[model samples]
Target chain A: MKRILSIMGFVFAMGSITSLLIIGMDALTFERILANEQALFQSKVLDAFDVPYTTATINEVFIQNVEAIELDVNGETVTVYRDPKTGRISMEISGGGVWGPIIGVLTLEPDFVTIANVAILQQEETPGLGGRITEPAYLAKYIGVVFNPDVVVTKNIPSADNEVDAITGATGTSTRFQIILNDTHAKLFPLLQALEN
Target chain B: MNRFWKRLQYTKWFNISKDGIFKENPIVVAVLGICSALAVTNRVENAIAMGLAVMFVVTASSLVVSAIRNFIPSRVRMITYMVIISSFVILVQMFLEAFFPVIAASLGAYLGLIVTNCIVMGRAEAFAVKNPLKYTFFDGVANSLGYMWILIAVAFFREILAFGTLLNFRVMPDTWVNWTVMALAPGGFFVLALIIWGVREWAKYFDVAAE
Candidate 1:
């Protein structure tokens, strides 16, 4: 009876120690983990447009310059000044992707047809499939292509400036990419054109 | 304190290491942890991450089990192992999520499933409970490494054929006709079967790892 009691006491003591160790580790790492996630979000958004910023720098910029807001189904409106260095009014047009969603900040050079930058915010797609749409191979196709309001998934090249190839197995994802891009351009370009006056 | 020191000497480090890789080969003989083998083995990077996660969980759990072996009830041994294993598993998940969020997300539900892996429970019950503290630690490390190598073997074939890459390093040229079929889960079973066959042959040559 003494031996059994001793064994039980030993097990209970050890269990408490293990639990304490696990809880200690979790408490120590929790804050850094949350910060890393937020930093990742900013980096992905900036990468979509070809804007260069490290994780730390991205957080610094987003905290001061960017604003987050929810929108109805059409999309959210993000407005950035043309010269962030000097204030000039401009608008960001954003929308969804097929598998999940994406928000792009579309900016134009002085000429309405020319693109300054486009930063995509969110995407959740099948990796190596729909996910490849964000790669330079796909996104570069959109770089100089003029945004058309009536964009459709087309096999035949519309023309160099107007067409982009759909990702082979991920046509739905590409189609969503085009739709969001076109809607942003269609609504925002005219508004910017009016603002120019 | 003197009793603790004496107990530590009996753990038998050499036997613990040899047993994990040979006597109780987790994948070959025990046939445990096959789920991650199928899912993560599709890519070498994913395989490595899964292996590391398992290693961390296994080593941590074994140590905790050893440290607490005496108090656990014989009737509730499995429950005790589960609690210890799950704590480490959760810790692994949180670490992966914090540092390597992409890999963590890719692993998805399988990360949580590590707690239920039979090899971990087997080690705790068969060895850690009977052994001293230090030897149990080595057993956990060796078993996890052995399991990791098998996973890498499966990943090597699947990743090369499916994506024409090894651990995300480009190998096959762009024009190479990639095998889409290799990327699917069915390919993992095929690769695992081939590995098992190879291990059996090697074991036969050396007269090792028999039953």
Candidate 2:
């Protein structure tokens, strides 16, 4: 009994100390991490709305042009950014990619059916292959695109209202990304309509 | 007395440092931490960031593991080391996310995976647990340096071929066709293999010349 107690005590002591260290570290960086996340989210939102912002002026632009809100949809609380002037809304959205979740901000046009723009906030795809999804050249195709009916990503040249030229080497990411786009848009369009009404 | 001091510092500490950096380089020779070496070596900026992150994790974990060596039970020692190493890795991830979000994003899952990096665990088990704090510190620095240089070199060649750029600055001419394979997994494999071969050849020649 004494031997078991000693072992248990050792385990508890070690576990608690490790937990405290992690907690202390997390507490120290919590605020800064939150700010960084906010900055990245705002930058993506601005990009999606096609608002011009430099490193020095992004926060100002976001504050001036965007009103932010948090809402629950399908048991997930998502932050959405609205451009009060344009009535276009940007939402934090994510879906699975090849290795992990691909996270991004999506902004819709004033009509709420067409995509104004999109900018990828985070991804874990192959660095030089699927990772091109985050590159500007690929994302540029999303600007002012109409995604209603069905959004498509294809390897061939995009020639339709919902067509986007897939990244040359990243077919998997493009296909999965299309799925995410269609799903998120389908899920949110009605909720957005309810909010507008 | 001075000769003895020279042998202790130079023949000992200097050799340890040199071995880690060149002779028994962690990446090329030991080949212990190959996962991050390949994963993050696609870009020079990412390689540097990863190297620095590993250096911090290995050094901090080694320090703590060494400090607690005497008290930890032999059976639970591995688990304890893991806990220490992971704590440092999480701390690094948090710091990078807070201060260097660009790097944090680019690195992504690999940053959190640093806890699994064998270099930290290997050093703890082989050196830090048995050595005094000073020597353990030296060992940590040496191994990280070994790991850093190899990663940087791999990134250098890969970036130049893959993107025709180094550090994202255009270096290749407009007419240059980027070798598509150079930016992918095959490129990493090919480049790392070439490096290992080149290092072995150089060492062989150096040894022959000395003889």
Can you give the TM-score per candidate against the true fold? 0.63, 0.84
Q: What is residue B180's positional error in candidate 2, in angstroms?
A: 3.7
Measured by TM-score, the strongest candidate is: 2
Instruction: For candidate 2, write residues A52-107 as lDDT tens digits.
Output: 99877888999998887766787988667898878889987799999889998888
lDDT of 1 by residue, B71-120 (tens): 67776778788878888898888888777878886787689999888888
Q: Residues A1-197, candidate 1, lDDT per residue (tens digit)?
A: 98678667756765796689778878878887788766765565444434567655888765565444322334755444444332222344455666566654555555555554555435676766887765665665555555544445566765655676778888777777777767766656665666557
Error of 1 at B2 (Å): 37
Candidate 2 residue B141 Cα shift, in angstroms, is 0.5
User: Candidate 1, A113: how far from true, in Å?
Assistant: 19
DockQ of each: 0.32, 0.65
Candidate 1, DockQ to 2 decimals? 0.32
